[model samples]
Target: MRRNWIIAEFTYDDLIAVYIVDVSQVRGNLKQIDNSRLDVTYEYYPNDVDVFIFQYSVDLFMSDGFPILERPILNKLYERKSLYSRSGYGRVANQVYFMVEFPYRKCGLLSYLNPREEQLFQRWGAKEIHLTAAWDGKVIWRRFGYQPPEDEFAILGLRYQHWATIHGIEYQEPQNINDFPEEFLKDDCVKLITMYKVLEECI
Candidate 1:
């Protein structure tokens, strides 16, 4: 049950810890990533792998400011299950890899997303999710809960006044979980999109 680091080209220097999500329970617990087990190459890691999902969390410092710990999913290894696309834009997502980056801090490319990444998130019932600097903006990160309630960057980006009018949280980002049968939020999100200032003030 142990191996050596096989994929050598994609190692991030500041990575603090590696974890594998054990879905054997409700979703699952994060098992610390074992560098020794990194022995499997990408070719086999996502290919022959099945039955468990992995998340890599790293503690990073953005700049001379404070140190914040954010989770950039390194890879989502999904077990091969029957897949059907309702919207006509569906395809088999063997496994998905996510690449993350922090524009500043001199830190380089944080991680990589392999394929069908978004589909996997939607399938398992994520509230709202995001990929940093990835065009989609906060639209994705809002999955778990409320994430600052605006589709703008964390630093210098200004919030668009039309947030409420934008769309409901469920609609902007929908999940397949039973908890949120209506994954799309109501017109509240859309309305907020238009009046971001008001929402900001209330928050």
Candidate 2:
């Protein structure tokens, strides 16, 4: 009922590591840091209120190619904010999905501290971390021993009809961005790409 988070920042050697933990769990010991070497900061984020930390592209759904969208119109919907997984736990109980990892770059290896982060998430009682990544995200995740089960998909597609109505954009089931009126592309264009990963350990 009370969703809580603990964000911690530490300087380990040259890497300035920052991570989040869910405070809901009562089991497991929090990682012990060497006080002399530790320089850290902490913050809290609560549940009940959904937090939006980043924006994602809906560009892939704009036009279909490999792993084409099932329904371009239904699949173009987008949510401006990311939320905690009801499954619970991970970075802020997977509370806020940040658009931190992408095709251009990926989450870096935390060296020896990687285990500590995992232990922290386990301590926080996270069942899994859910996220949507571009198709290429699979390559990035695979290096970490995690892979998105779904190859291509979409989220927040229901808003398409309403968006079209307000923008005066024509409705088409098999939506194509090219067919869109010039004004629609200029005013309310949307896109998407490979939607990957949902409810999986993010270690």
Candidate 3:
């Protein structure tokens, strides 16, 4: 099928937004800005325009009792040139791989996020930003544009900015994103986490 993604870019005041779809509640006619549908596979649209304008993320699964990776921890360090956000759509769709981005400083009243991070997200044309304060290992898909499975969860597209513009209006300060996971804090996993932002988006 010849598919085309309806994309729009604008400043925060321009009212740009991300389309966050409830994957568990997709029905049909996703052509509308607020409308959404179930997750689709690559083979479903062989002749479609592979247009990924910004970053995106989704939760996923490997197998029964198989451990899912905390990829975002590493993925986040590459903030600007990368994509970040999570959706429970992966496991529901029976797949692996997700996306991740650095966490913005917590909001206080009405002006959260570091000016530098915000500028970076904006410069990358992300327009939208979404993330939960806490991590839910039982859930929470990684954040990035990974190959999608056949299912979807909550989808936040270009419309995410709208949510931020309205609700995330609060003061924010720099937050120290722990490079290492708690499992490694005591040197159990013994993995090292030394990260820095990458200038290149695609590898």
Candidate 4:
């Protein structure tokens, strides 16, 4: 039987030790899905104290019974690379916070994974989460409640104007994700900005 193993451990307190074990269990559960195997790395930075990073990647294959071309997009072979970090301070002192970087996964897989990850974050006392949304993620992450910081709204408005001018579309300042023009959704060439959520809003 395959099992999840720790690549490294640098625990300074009970909280971090428990967090590490929780991550291992999550990895094990991930492996059970479609008999997929995952490579996970967990690291703790002592110099920064209270900073931890976790990364994992997996490639899932479809069953032979499924027709290659007919397979749903979600079931098609795709690699997922995700990175997460926890910090002690951000917008508050001694806060448990998370920064999600370069997380790319199919919607179906994310449906299975996000709740589990959120549970871990909540248990670890996460107060905020930040991430940069890219590609289709700009839409997906917004649906998950991440929004641009207050200061970023102006910058996004400027970007919207630029895109509208290039695409010959009407320009309207977008104050939030919902206000963005439809063209922004279809244009992958447009760059997205960082988004964040205060945990209290969701929890």
Candidate 5:
């Protein structure tokens, strides 16, 4: 599939802005610019054959045009560049692995990015999204409908028990990801577990 850059406009927190979907194709070097509002840039890196690394950074400004925060908020590494099917076989699926770092959690950035990400997935014909949820991501990604595999859940249960023991808290064997306590997600004792979300008929 040919790679094409996309431009999109978004309105969030009463702020309106336009951002490029793939900035690397256009900007070869980072240059300082005046921050009039929220500025977002997406970058694409071809890491290997059929694998790509994608990232987006944000420069946030207040309603009064005061710069608040500027940092990279999301990174995704994915494989299988396009949809393909072998003779007598069904369409093959691929996965996009991602990590997020949002300094301002309440800024509604994730809400703005989720749909755009789904669009990207559709373009790549990816059927699953995966991540290693740690720290706040454990709860955040769970809320976003990502779930750990059963085997990983069992391992998480063991880690949860150990964490509870160390904190002198009552331990209840977690039946699922939701069974884990919210407090445990905020701590470093819990092991980072693989979580995945299966997309519905992206094609």
Candidate 6:
């Protein structure tokens, strides 16, 4: 009935939302992620952990403007790939987690995947799907037909410092979402989408 937050200590602040993908409904969604030209890959982890990783570069801001968001990710792309290759495992993931970072503002991630990737997951048995992002980013998700969970941080046993560490970013844990820095809250933040709704839509 509820989602699980899989928090890992990484070079970046990452809060992977874990979900069980409906075996029957994921085929089409898989196709969508595959068809889209995004660099995506998944690694298998033994003992029931599956790691899915994806990367896409976009020019969200002018080529020269410091590009606060892009720099860190762009720089660590190779390192991440290397790390996943070493520790990631392959299996019919009954549970899946996605950590995607959107263009600036600050601190949040996305779960938007292309067709091929989704297909691979479906083929493997991706049952549970989890999403994590900044509090403000929930607004962006709503625009995309996603209904987010309320108070995910409290519900998921997660906090801002954990998120900051996962992404290797500086994080000042806010006592309340409203207390977030105006600049950071100006753009996307973390959020999640459940598999039940995903199935409902596919149906």
The lDDT leader among the candidates is: 5
- The lDDT per prediction is 0.27, 0.30, 0.25, 0.44, 0.54, 0.31
Q: Provide the global lDDT of candidate 2 against the true structure.
A: 0.30
Q: All candidates' TM-scores?
A: 0.24, 0.30, 0.18, 0.54, 0.58, 0.28
lDDT for 19 in candidate 1 is: 27
Off by over 4 Å in 2: 1-39, 47-92, 95-108, 131-138, 149-203
lDDT of model 4 at residue 44? 24
RMSD of each: 16.5, 16.7, 20.3, 10.5, 9.2, 15.6
Report, for all candidates in order, the number of backbone clashes: 44, 8, 23, 0, 0, 42
lDDT of 3 at 56: 30
Give every collision pair in model 2.
58-191, 58-192, 59-191, 59-192, 60-192, 61-192, 89-93, 89-126
Q: Which candidate number has the best TM-score?
A: 5
Return model 6's CA RMSD, one decimal.
15.6
Give the least accurate 10-residue stretch of model 1, judged by summed lDDT. 194-203
Error of 4 at 174 (Å): 2.0
The TM-score that candidate 4 achieves is 0.54
> Residue 114's C-alpha lDDT in candidate 1?
14
Global local distance difference test of model 6 = 0.31
In TM-score terms, candidate 5 sits at 0.58
**Model 5 C-alpha lDDT per residue in residues 1-203, reported as the tens digit of each score:** 11344322222311123322232222212112234555655556665553555545555444555444433344453544332211232222223333333433444445545656655555544566666776667788787777886777878788888999988999987877888888887777775767766666743
Ranked candidates, highest TM-score first: 5, 4, 2, 6, 1, 3
Q: RMSD of model 1, in Å?
A: 16.5
Which sequence of candidate numbers ranks them by lDDT, best first? 5, 4, 6, 2, 1, 3
lDDT of 2 by residue, 95-182 (tens): 2222321321222312233344445444433444344433333233334333322222122223445567886867664232223343
| Two-way lDDT contest, 4 vs 5, winner | 5
